[model samples]
Target: MFAVIRTGGKQYVVKPGDRIKVEKLEANVGDTIEISEVLLVNKEGEVKLGNPVVEGAKVVASVVDHAKGPKVIVFKKRAKKGYKRKKGHRQLITTIEIKEIL
Candidate 1:
């Protein structure tokens, strides 16, 4: 079965045993997290969709690790004025392994 869940202001379609990286969450490795914001679920050719979220439906996942995305560089310059600016950023991320859908 597969389910659509929302996390970190994003939506992800995930199945059992799937590993996905999401925005940082307050959990450690091996910790179980329940994603209750299930938007949709499909099983055995049947589908269930919620108006906002499905009640009593949840996607269970285990924290795999904490990570950071690749750095993104921002550069700005003005011609002739000799003005320049450079910045870089990396987003914090968490990897979770889907354990079950309930």
Candidate 2:
């Protein structure tokens, strides 16, 4: 079965044994996390879509690791005024392995 879930302001479609990287969460590696914001679920040939989220539907996953995304550079330049600015940022991320969708 597959499920569509929301976490940290983003939506992801995942299935059992799937590993996905999402925005940073509080749990540490090896911890089990329950995602209750399930938007849709497909089991066999049956599909269920929620009006936002499905009731009593959840996805169970385990935290596999924590890391950061690649750095993004931001550069701004002005015309003949000779003004320039540069910045770099990397977003914190967490990888989780989907165990089940219920």
Candidate 3:
């Protein structure tokens, strides 16, 4: 089965055995987390969509590792004015493996 879950202000469609990277969560590596904000579920060829979220529906996943995404550089410049600013950022991320949709 596959499910759509929301976490950290984002939504993800996931299925068992699928690995995905999401915003960092307050849990250790290998910890199992249940995401209850399931928006939709598809089992076999049957699809069920929720009104925002489905009651009693959940997605289970295990944290595989903690990681940092690649750095993103932001540069700003003003024409004819020697004004420039540069910044870099790396997002904290968690890699999780989907285990089930319930």
Candidate 4:
């Protein structure tokens, strides 16, 4: 089965055993977390879509590791004024493996 779940202000489509990186979550590796904001679920052609979220539906996942997303650079410059600025950032992320959709 596959499910659409919301976490970290984003939505992801996942299935059992699938691994994905999501915005940082306060959990350690090997910890199991339940995503209760399930938007949709499909099982053997049977589908369930939530109005906002499916009532009583959840996706179970296990934290694989903590990670950091690729660095992003921001540069700014002003014409003849001789002004320039540069910045870089890396977003914190978490890797989780989908265990089941229920």
Candidate 5:
């Protein structure tokens, strides 16, 4: 079975054994988290879509690690003007392994 879940203002399609990086979560590594914002679920050719979210549907996942995403450089400049700015940012992220869709 597969499920679409929302976390940290983002959505992700996941299945058992699949590992994905998502916005930072508060739990420590090896902690199991249940994502209840299930938007859709597919089971052996059967599909169920939710009106906002499916009732009683959830996804179980285990936190694998915590890391930072790649740096993004932001630069701005104006022609004939001495206005310039540069900034870099790295997003905090959590790596989790999907264990089941329930």
Candidate 6:
């Protein structure tokens, strides 16, 4: 089965044994996290959706690792003004392995 869960203002569709990187969470490797903001779930082609979130539904996952995304560069310049600026950023993220859906 697969379920759609919301976290860090983003949604993810995940299934058992699937590993995905999500926004940073306050957990360490091997930590088990329960995500209760399940928006939808499909079991054997049987679909169920929630108005906002499905009550009594949750996705259990284990933290795999903490990671950082690729750096993104931002540059700004003004023509003939000799003004320029450059910046780079990397977003913190967490990798988790789906363990169960309940």
- C-alpha lDDT of all candidate models, in order: 0.96, 0.97, 0.93, 0.96, 0.96, 0.95
The list of candidate 1 runs beyond 4 A from truth reads none
Question: Which stretch of 10 consecutive residues in model 4 shows the poorest summed lDDT?
Answer: 1-10
Candidate 3 wrong stretches, greater than 4 Å: none
Highest-scoring model, lDDT: 2
Q: What's the ranking of the predictions by TM-score, best on top?
A: 5, 2, 4, 3, 6, 1
What lDDT does candidate 5 reach at residue 19?
Answer: 99
What overall lDDT, based on C-alpha atoms, would model 2 receive against the true structure?
0.97
Off by over 4 Å in 4: none
Tell me the lDDT of candidate 5: 0.96
What TM-score does structure 5 among the candidates reach?
0.97
The lDDT of model 3 is 0.93
What lDDT is reached at residue 60 by model 3? 86
Q: What is the C-alpha RMSD of each candidate to the true structure, in Å?
A: 1.2, 0.7, 0.9, 0.8, 0.6, 1.0
Residue lDDT tens for model 2, 1-102:
899999999999999999999999999899999999999999997999999999999999999999999999999999999999999999999999999999
TM-score, every prediction: 0.92, 0.96, 0.95, 0.95, 0.97, 0.94
Candidate 3 residue-wise lDDT, 1-102, digit = tens: 788899989999899999999999999998999999999999998989999899899888999999999999999999999999999999999999999899
Instruction: Summarize candidate 5's per-residue lDDT along 1-102 as a digit string, tens digits.
Output: 889999999999999999999999999999999999999999999999999999999999999999999999999999999999999999999999999999
lDDT of 1: 0.96
What lDDT score is found at residue 100 in candidate 4?
91
Residue 40 of candidate 1: its Cα lDDT? Answer: 96
* Candidate 5 positional error at 77, Å: 0.8
Residues 1-102, candidate 6: write the lDDT tens digits: 899999999999999999999999999899999999999999899988999998889999999999999999999999999999999999999999999999
